[model samples]
Target chain A: MDIYDILFWVLSAIAVSCALGVILSRNPVNSVMFLILTFFAISGHYILMNAQFLAIVNVIVYAGAIMVLFLFVIMLMNLNADVEPQKGQLVQLAGVISGGVLFLVVLAGIKSARPVTIDKAASDIGLITNLGKVLFTKYVLPFEISSVLFLSAMIGAIVIGKKEDAKPIAPRDEEL
Target chain B: MPVNSTHYLFLSLLLFSIGIMGALMRRNAIIIFMCIELMLNAVNLLLVAFSKIYGDADAQLFVFFIMVVAAAEVAVGLAIIVMMYRKVHSVDINILNRLKH
Candidate 1:
């Protein structure tokens, strides 16, 4: 096996185990930590695939931003392992079984598919320069739309989280 | 054997299944939300792999869009969760069963 293969295996193992840790950890904080590790492992995979921009973005956005948001919410709620609710043993078992069955079904379905080998050499398409060109020239509309989406999401969160006042409104003389 | 598209496929599938299991097994709303993130990451990994395989940048760009949407989703979702907690004083989704009544 070459270095890429070894690196791929190492990252894959780390990713899978950390993903399990995310699910199995009792504490929400522990789960968030594990998820961060999992995201890092995935980012490593992105780098290995020569997607430099994606790798950086994955680290900055997923591991850095989104996970911190999760941790903040968990801390805001002050959740602890002792108070964490869990599914019953039977339900947990069923969940595991169903997930395994789905995995097996998909695995079997893809078993016969052709395995296209990736070029181990570097590709320039994933570079920031090329990606920016494509984004601004071809994908500019969607990019702007996403900014709008972000604005709406921000507004929605504020509206939803705002507390309602207890005082009732009095009828106006004009309305009367 | 050298790393190929199939290997990445397997990895992504395994991750996705684990995410599904987590979502199904967890009763905490935040944990469920994290599991959904895990599943989304799995799909992102797969998309990146395919992008490499086809020598295309579109899939990676798609992954970017997915991240954007995920961020927006997390913001709105966590706000809802916090609102729920404020109202019911618990993040346990079982408490939401009262909505059925």
Candidate 2:
């Protein structure tokens, strides 16, 4: 195998193993840590694909910020491995069937994909430069919409995270 | 033949399947959240591989959007998980079957 092949195998193994660890870890904090590792490995794969900006952003946004928030929640709640509900055989069977369908569909998709020759030497970046153009110019509406979504999510999270009060005031526009 | 785009496709498929397995089988809410992240990463891999194959940056850009969405999802999801924990004291999803209200 060539260098590319070896790197692919190694990176993918790290990604898959960390992903498994995310699911298998009993503690939520540890699971989030594993999830961060999974994101880091995937970032490495993006670097391998020559998307350096994407790799950096992936690490910063995912492994750095989002997962830190997750850890904060886990710790704030004081979740421990003990006192968690146990799994049942039915859950495993459901998992098996669901995973089986996902596997089948993906395998069929791979079989059906038409062969396409990839060009690796395209402009070293469409990352920060051209991607900004696409996001702002071509997909401007969607970008704005995403901002709105995030704003709403920020509000919703604030609302949810607030300490419970005696009564929450309903909006004026609600039914009188 | 040596491995190529097809192999990447298979790898992504397997990862997606594994994510599905985790989502379906795991009783913990945190584990389900992680599985969803894995599925998103699997899609990102497929997107990057296709971007390489097609000589396009659009897929890479989409990957950026996916990362953004995944971040938002985890933020909101964890917040809700915290809410659940406040009421129930456990994040294990298996015991959460009182949804008939």
DockQ scores for all predicted structures: 0.86, 0.61
Per-residue lDDT of model 1, residues B30-93, tens digit only:
9899999999999999999999989999888899999999999999999999989988888888
lDDT digits (tens) for residues A130-159 of candidate 2: 778777887788778788888888888877
Best by TM-score: 1
Candidate 2 residue A149 C-alpha distance from true site, Å: 1.0
The segments of candidate 1 whose C-alpha lies over 4 angstroms from its true place after superposition are: A166-176
The interface RMSD values of the models, given in order, are 0.7, 1.9
Error of 1 at A42 (Å): 0.3
TM-score between candidate 1 and the true structure: 0.95
How close is every model to the real structure, measured as TM-score? Answer: 0.95, 0.88
If you assessed candidate 1 against the hidden native complex, which CAPRI class would it receive? high
Q: Model 2, B1-101: lDDT tens per residue?
A: 44478877887887888888888887878778878878888899889888777667789888888887777777778878887887777787755788622
Worst 10 residues of 2 chain B by lDDT: B92-101
